[model samples]
Target chain A: MGKLVYLYGIIPEGHDINELWDPEKSAIEGEDLPYVEDFGGLAAVVTKVSEDEFGETAMEENSNNTAWIQEKAFHHHEALLELQRHTTVLPMKFGTIFESVESLKQMIEEKEEHLQHTLQTLEGKEEWNVKAYINPKTFYERVAEANENVKAKREEIEQMSKGRQYLETKKLDKFIEEEMFKDQEKKAEEMYDRLAGYSEDSERKKNWKKDVTGREDEMALNSAFLVVSEDLESFLDQIREMEKEKEEDGWLIEATGPWPAYHFATMEE
Target chain B: MPIEQSTRSDSIVDVLELVLDKGVVIAGDIRVNIADVELLTIKIRLIVASVDKAKEIGMDWWESDPFLNSQAARKEVEDENRELKERLEKLENSMASDRTQIGEDNK
Candidate 1:
C-alpha cells in the first residue's frame, strides 16, 4: 500500500511557503514535516505518513487513546498555526488522510472552487472564543437577595413548624435551583447577543458541565465569534464593558482569540 | 472592567474537537481487515460549530445527547433525592431510638 498524506489545510495560490520557514526543519516535532501540494491556484499543506500507523485499524486504536490524540492533534494544530502566520489557512479537520499525493491532488482539484470561496471569505479574519462563567453559590445568593418571591418563601419557612419547615426549605431550594438555571440561560443569551453585535458571525458553543470544566463556577456562556482583524480591538472593548456590567452579579468573562476560524469554516452544503 | 484571557496553553482538546467536528472529508479505498474480514474503514468528515451554527448546517447531535442535555440534570436531582431520603431515614431512626431509651429510663 502507498503512504497516506495527512492534510492540514488549504491556502490561497502564490502564498510564499518558503518565507514562513522551511517545513523540513521546523520545531513542530514528532511527525512528518508538512509540505504544500499545489493544485492550480490553491495548495494543500500535507505531510506523509505510513499506512501502517495511520491505517484504519491503527487510527481506530489510537483514537481511543487520549494521549495519542492530544499529541497528534496538537501537532496538526501547530502546523496550521504556523502556516496561518504566512497566509490565510482553511484548516482541515484532524486525520484527513488521503491514500496518496496524486489522489490528494485530484480531490483538491475537484473542490478547488469551494475551497477558494471559503478561503476568500475567511481571509484577514480570525475566530475568538468567549466563555462566561458565574460563581453559582454567590450568584444564587445575589439573585435570592434581589428577588421578593424568594424572600417571602424564606420568611414563610421560618414561621413554620419544625417538620413543615424542613420540607418547605427543601422545596424552596428546588425552586431556587430551577430559577437559577433559567436566569443563567437568560444571561448567556443576552451576553451572546451583545457580543454578536460586534462580530461578523457568532456561534453559541455547548456549555461544559462543571466537572468537565473543572471549575467552581458554572459555565454560563460558551461561544465563538468571527471577528475581522480591524474589529478585534472593538470586540475586546465590548467584552471589557460586559465584564464591568456583570461583575457585581458574580459573572466572569474569559476570551481567547485570533485563532484559526475553526467555528466559521463550515462549507456551504 | 477586568477582562481575563484564557490561560490554557495546551489547546489540543479544543483543536481535536474542532478538527473532528468540522472540515472536508474525502473518501478513499482504504480499509483494514483480519483474515479477509474488514475491521475498519477510513471515512471521516468533521464540522465543528456552535449549537445554532450546527443546526443551521443540519448537524445538531449535542442537542439530543442525554448526557449533555436536561436528562443529565434530572439524573443529578435524582441522586440528590436518594441521598436526602437516606439522610431523612437516618434522622427518623435516631429520633425513634432516643425516644425509646428515654421511655425505658423513666420506667
Candidate 2:
C-alpha cells in the first residue's frame, strides 16, 4: 500500500504525540501511523494515509465529491480538535498532504521563522466567530412604526384608491429596505467596536446570505475575535450583553468557539 | 497542546470556512493548493449551492440548519423526531437491564 504524509498542524517541540491523541479515535479508520516529526524546534503533526485517495490527481477528482468532501472536512476538524486540546496548533489548512515526508519537512524548514512567529502570536489566544442577524419580524415592525416617513405614508395610503395603495405598498417595502440597510450598518459597526474591546484581535468577514446561513433573518455582521483564555469570560459576557440589548433593535448576536486561532495563525509576509 | 474537552459546534459551512477558507498555506504536493483562498471559496460556494438543491429534493445533509422554510423545516424536525424516538426506545430497553441501579439512585 502506497502511503502519503497528511499534516494536521505544527507546534514547538515538547509534546509526545502518542499521549496527545488516541489512534482508536483517528479520523480515518484502520490507520495507525499518526506521529510527530521534529524539524529543528518545531514539530509537524502528521499521519500516513493511502496515496491512492490523497495523491494529486485523486484529490482533484474527489474535490467535488460531496460525500468525500464531507468525510475529509469532518475528519480534519476532528483530528485538529484533538491536537488543539494538547497544544497551540499552527493548523495546516485542510488537504495539506505531501508526496513524501521529505518535501513536507523541506517546506517546514523554509518557513520555520515565519511559522514560529505565528505560533508565538497564537499561543494563548483562541478564535471566536461572531455573527449578527437582522430579525425581520420585530425589527421591520419597530422601524416602520417609528419612522416618520412610514407613519406619514401609512396615513397617505389610507386615503389612496386600491390601485394606488398597491403601488404605495410596493414603494413602502423599497423604502423599508433602504432603511434596514442603513440601520444594519450603523448597528453592526457599533456592536463590532464594543466586541473588539474584549479580544486581542478582530477581523470583519463577509456576511453569509440567507441561503448559506439557512436562516430567514439576514446576516449583517460576520467577524472573528481572538480572545485570550483569561479574557474569554469577559468576551462571552459582552456577547451575552449585546445579544440581549440588540434584540429589541432587530439584531441577534451569536459568538461561537474557543477554537484554534485560524484567523491569527496566518503566515503571510 | 491546549486541546481542551470543549466541544465547539460547527455546521458543514463552518467546517468549510475554517478548514478550507483559512489556515497556514504551506503549499502541498497535492492538487489542493488552497493558497488561492478566494478561488477555493468560490468552489465551496458552488458545492454549497448544490447542497441546497439536494435539500429541495428531500435529500438531507448532515449539519444542515433547522431554519429552512416551513416545508423543509418540518421535514428536518420529522427526521430528528424519528431519530429521537429510536434513541428513546433503545434507552428504554437499556433501562430494563439497569432498573436496580435506577431504583437505588432514585432513593
Candidate 3:
C-alpha cells in the first residue's frame, strides 16, 4: 500500500498554484490532494494514490465497477479543468500512476518538448463539445410530409383495395426510409462543417449510441472543437440558431464544455 | 436489435470517453491499458465511430440504423415499432384471408 503518483495533467512552470487547494476542500476518499511538481519549464499536476488502489490490477478491477470509474473519471476531468482555467494543460489519460516521482519525471522529461508545444497551441483556447441529434421518427414524418413521391403514393394507395393498400403502405415506408438515409448523410455533413468553422481545430468525435446517451434520438454528429475563448459565444450562437431552424425536423443540438482539450491534448502538431 | 445492459449514467460517458480513451498517453511504470477494463467501451457503449470502424467492430446497426438524421434513438425505436406493427398487420390480414379459404374448403 505504498504511495503512487497519479498524474492529472501538465502545465507551464512558475504560476503560484496555491489557490488550487482549499485547505478545507475535501479530497476523493480522504486521498491526498493534488500538488504541482516543478519539472523546470513544465509542471505536472498530481496526487498521491495508493499502490493497492491505482495499481494495474486495481485499475482493471475498478474499471469494471461502474460507480467507481464514473466518480473517478469525473474527478479526473474536473482536476484538468481546474488547471486549464489557470494555464494551458495537457491532460493525461485516466489512471496514470507511477511507482515513484522519479519515473514520472523521467516520462515528462522525455515528452517535455511536445508537451510545451501542445500547451502553446492550447493557450486561451477551450475545447467545446457539440453533439447533434435527429429524431428518426420526426425526420421521417417531416420528410414524408414534404416529399412529393410520398404524397403521390398516398393518393395511389387510397385508390387501392384493402389488400393492395397494405402492400402499398409498406412500399411507401421503404421509400421514405431510403430518402431519409440520403438526407441524413447530407444533413450530418453540412452540420459538421458548419460547426467546425467556429473552432481552430476540430475532431470528429464518435457519437455515443442510445445505450450511452440514454436518449432515444440518434446522434448524427459528436464533435469537439478547439475554440478560442473569445469566440465561444459565436460557436454556441451557431448551435442555437441551427437548432431553432431545424427543431421541427427532430434535430437536436447539444453543446457542452470548456473541457480540458482531452482530444487535442497530444504532442502531434 | 440489441441494447446491452448498462448501469452507467449518461453524464459520465463523455468524460470517460475523453479522459480514458482520448487523452495523452505517457507510459507509466505501473501502466493500465484501459482496454483491459472491459467496461471502458461498454460504459461508453456504441460510440458510432466512422462507418469503417463501425463495420470492423461489427456494429452494423447503422446500416439500417432505424434512426436517421440524429433524432437520438427514440424516434427510430418508435418508427421501428410502427413499421413492425404495420408489417404484422399486413401478415395478419393475409392470414385471415387464408383462413377464409380454409373455411370454404372445410365446408
Candidate 4:
C-alpha cells in the first residue's frame, strides 16, 4: 500500500481525537511507517505515496479526466465540510496533498497556536464568496449615453480628414480603454461600499489567472466577511435589494457560503 | 432559498479576489498530466468561488464579444442542435418500431 495524504482542515485546541479520528483506512495504506497524528483543533490525514506508482506518468494519465478529479475533489470537500459542521475548521483548498502523515503532524504542531487563534476568530463566522460581473451590453450602452466627451471624440474623428481620422480613432481607442477601466473601478468601489457594512472583514481579491470562461482581463473583486450567524438574514436581504438596484449597472453580485475560512485562515509558521 | 445579500460598508468582497488572490500557497514540483501526455506543470491555482457569479461573467463576456455574431459559428451551433434533435427523434422512432415489430411477432 502506497501512501496518499488528505489534508482535512485547521482546527482549534480541545478537539477529542478519539471521537474525531477514524482508524487508518485501507484505501490510504502505505508502509507501516511511524504515523504522527496530532492536530491543533485541526486534523490532517496522510498516507505514503508509492513514488513509482504515482510518479509523473500516473498523474498524467489521470489529468484531463475531469470526472476523476471532480470525484476526488468533491469527496475531499465533503470530508472537510463534514468536519466543519461540528468543529471550527479552516478548510484547506481542494487538491492539497502531503507526503506522509508524520509530515502532516509536524506541520500542524508547528502551526498549532496560529491555527488555534484562526479557528477561534472564525468560530461562528462562515466564509461567504461574493463575485460581481459587469453586464457588457448595459455598461457599453450606459457609457455611450452618459459620456458626452466620448461622443464628441467619436464625432470629431468621424468628421476628420482620413489620415487625421485614423490617428484620432487610435486616440479614441486608448480613451475607451481608460474609460472602461475607470468604470470597472467605479463599479467595484460602489459595490464594496454597499457590502462592507454587512461584513466584519472584506477584501478585493485580484484574479490574475485565466478562468474556465477563457476571458482574459476579467475583473474579480473577491472579498470575505466575518458575519455573526444571527445577522446572516439581514445580510442576504440587503444583497437581494442591491442586486435589483444594480441590475442595469452591469453588476452581478453573487454569494456562496457559510464555508470554512479557506481564504482568511493563515498558519503562523 | 433566501439569498443572503451583502451589506454596504467601505469593504467590498469579490469572490474572485478571495479564491484567486488569497490562500495558503505551497509551491512544489507541479505537473499536469492529460491522457498520458505530460503538459508542463501548468501552474494550478485553486480558486473557490460562487458558481453563479462565474456564469454571469462568462455570459456577459460572451455576449459582448464582436466575434459571437460570426455567421459560421452561429450556424455551427444551429447545426449541432438540429443534428441532436434528429438523433433523438431517430432513437425514439427506432424504439417505437421495435415495439410494434415485437407486438406483431407475438401475435
Candidate 5:
C-alpha cells in the first residue's frame, strides 16, 4: 500500500472543516482527516490518495497519451477549486502529495511565515488571464500595409535575385518576423498599460513548447492580472473593448477570469 | 437543458498555476515520483503553422503505418521511449565532455 497525499491551501479564520470537505469521499478518508494543521491565518485542505492507484508506473504508462494526464490533473484542479469557494485559496499545483501527515505539518510549520505572508499579499485579489493570438492572415496583411519599404524590397528581390531566390526569401522572412514580433510586443504593452491600474501584480504565462493551442508562434503574450475583486467587471469590460479594437485589424485578443489569484502567489526561496 | 458550448474553451485564469506556483510547495511523497513524466505526457500537443497544417499532420499519422493497432502501437511507444532515453544519454555524455574540458581549461 502507498501513503497519503496532503493538500495545502488558504481558508478563512475559524472556517468549519466539515462544511468545506466531507473527507469521507477521499480515497483514504477512512484512514484519518490526514491531520489538518492551522496557521492562524488560513486552513490547509489536506487529503490522501491510494499509492497503487497513482504510482510512478501509472504516470509512465499514461504519459504516452496526453489526454489521460489532463483528465487526472483536471480532476485534481477541480477538487482544489471546490475548496476555493469558501475562502481565497492559493491553490497548489495538481501533484503536491506528501509522504505522511506529520511531514506535511512540519512543512507548514517551516513555511508558515512565508505562506501567511503570501496569503496576506493576495487578500481580495483575483486572477484574470489575458491572451493575445495573432491571426496570421490579418496580421500579415497589416504588416504588408505598414511596411512599404520591405514590400518594395521584396518585389525588387523577386525580379533581380532569381538565382539567389532562397537567400532573398530568407532576408524577406527575417524582416517580416522582426516586424511581427515588434508589433506583438507593442500591442501586449498597450494592453498591459490599460490593465495595470486594476492589478496589484501582473505576469506573463510561461511559454513552454506545447501543441495545445493551434498556433506555432509563441503565444504572443499570456498574462495573469491580479485585479481587486470589486474591479472585476470593469477589468473585463476594458478587455472586451481592447479585443474589439485589435480584432478590427485581425489580432485575436481574448481574456478569461475572476478566478482565485494563482499567479500573484510566490515562494520566498 | 442542452449543454451550452463555451465561446472560448481555454480560460486565462489558470487556477492550477496559482496553486502550484504560488501555493505552498510541500516536499512530500503523496505526489508521484515522476513529475517530469507528468509534464511530457499531459497532452498530445502538436504545434503547427495553422489549423489546416495540424489536421494534415493528424491525417498523415494514419497514412504512416499500422502504428494504431494495439501491438504496433505498443511497439511504437516503446521505440519512442527508447529514442528519448538514447537522446538523454547522448546529451549527458556531451555535457560531461564539456565539463571535463572546462576543468582542464581552469588548470
Candidate 6:
C-alpha cells in the first residue's frame, strides 16, 4: 500500500513543531499527529496515512459514515488548533492530501506569495464566535407587557362575544408570534452591531435551528468576530455586560474562541 | 465578562462543520485503480473555518436545508393545517345548507 501525506495547515517560517504541540499530551487516538515540513520559508504540518484508508473510494465511504467523519474530523481540527497556539497558521480544509512530500512542497512553493499574504494579514487576530439565545416564553411575556398593540388587542378581546372572542384570540396569537420574530431579529441586529465595535471585523452568522443547538431557547444571534489579540479581554468583558443587560429579556450569550483566525485567513488574490 | 476558551473536544461540531465547509482546495492526482482502470480520484478541498466563521465565508447550506430549518418546516405544516381547516369549514357549511333545504321541502 502506498503512503500519502495528509496536510493539516501552514505555519509561519521557522516555527518549531515541538514548541507547538506536546505529543504525550495531545496525541489523538487512532491517528498519527502532524509534523512540520519546511518548504522554503513556509512550513506545512502534515501526517502520514496509508493510501488504502485515505484514497478516494475509502474517503468517500468514510464521509458517508457520520461516526467515522466525526472522529477523523475532530482529530484533524485538534491538530490545527494545537498548532495555532504557537504561531500564525493558515489551516487547510479537511482531507487535503498529496501523493508525496515532494509534491506537497512544490505546491507550497507555487502558492508562497498568497500564503505569505494570508499569514501576514491574520497574524495578530483571532476568531471568536458569539451565540445569543432567548427564552421564547419569557420573551413573549415581556413583549406583551411592553407592546401597546398587544395590550389593546387583549382588552378588545375581553369585551367581544364568545365566538368572536375565540377568533380574535387566534388572530392575536398570530400577531404575537409575528411580533416576537420581528423583535428577535431586531435584537440580534443590535447585539451584532454592539459587538462589532470591539472587533477588527465581524460577520453575521446564520442562526441555527433549535434542534441543531439542542436548546429550547430561540437563537437570536449567531456571529463571528475577528478581534485583535490586544482587544480580546475587552471584547469578552463587553459580552458579559451585554448578557447582564439582556438577562431580564431572557437573553443568554455564549462566546467561544481566541482561536486560529479561521474566519479571517482568506488567501490573498 | 467571562470568556470560555474552546477546548479541543468541546468544539468538535464547530470544527467539523468548518473544515468541511470552508478551506483552500489544492488539487492533486492521488487515484488508485486496478489493471489500468481508474477506480478513484481524490479531490483535495479543505475548509479551515470554525462553525460561525464558516457562516461568515458563505458556507451556510444548513440555513436553507429543510431538515435543519425548523421555522421553515413549521411554516409548511401551518400552511397545510390552514388548508385542511378551510376544507372542513366548506364541508360543514354544505351539510348545514342541505338540512335547511330538506326542512323547507317538508314544510
Candidate whose lDDT is highest: 2
- Chain A vs. true chain A, TM-score per candidate? 0.88, 0.87, 0.87, 0.72, 0.78, 0.86
Which stretches of candidate 3 lie above 4 Å from their native place? A28-31, A147-169, A267-269, B1-10, B22-29, B35-107
In the order shown, the candidates' DockQ scores are 0.14, 0.17, 0.18, 0.08, 0.17, 0.17
Q: Per-residue lDDT of A1-269 in model 3, one digit per residue for the tens?
A: 68888888888897665765445434544558878899999988888888676777877676655446655776676666566666778887787788889998988888788888888988988887778888999999987888776788789899999999999898888988888777876787888899889889998866665534656788888888898999988988888888888898988887777777877887443
Q: Which stretches of candidate 4 lie over 4 Å from their true place?
A: A13-42, A45-65, A148-177, A207-211, A214-222, B1-107
> Going through the candidates in order, what is chain B's TM-score?
0.19, 0.33, 0.22, 0.19, 0.24, 0.19
Q: What residue pairs are clashing in model 2?
A: A84-B3, A85-B2, A85-B3, A85-B4, A86-B1, A86-B2, A86-B3, A87-B1, A87-B2
Judging by lDDT, tell me the better candidate of 2 and 3: 2
Give one digit per residue, the lDDT tens place, for model 4 in A1-269.
35445555656555654444443422221443212245644554333455444445554554344334333333344444446666777766443445556666666767677776776788877767666666666666677666667887788788889999888877875676667668777777777777778876666654332322223325445555666678777777777887788677676676766755766666543
Which ranges of candidate 1 are over 4 A from the true structure?
A: A22-32, A148-169, B1-10, B22-107
Worst 10 residues of 5 chain B by lDDT: B1-10
**Residue pairs with clashing backbones, model 6:** A93-B46, A93-B47, B22-B47, B23-B46, B23-B47
lDDT (Cα, 0-100) at B52 in candidate 2: 52
Candidate 1 vs. true structure, TM-score: 0.70
Please tell me which model should have the higher DockQ, number 1 or number 4.
1
Q: Name the top TM-score candidate.
A: 2
Query: True interface contacts reproduced by each model, as a fraction?
Result: 0.33, 0.38, 0.44, 0.15, 0.34, 0.41
The full ranking of all candidates by lDDT, starting with the best, is: 2, 3, 6, 1, 5, 4
- Candidate 1 vs candidate 5, DockQ winner: 5
Docking model 5 quality class = incorrect
True lDDT of residue A203, candidate 2? 94
Of 4 and 5, the candidate ahead on DockQ is 5
Q: What is the lDDT of residue B49 in candidate 1?
A: 14
Model 1, A106-202: lDDT tens per residue? 7777767887888888888888888899999888987777766677888888999999998988788787877788887988899899989998899
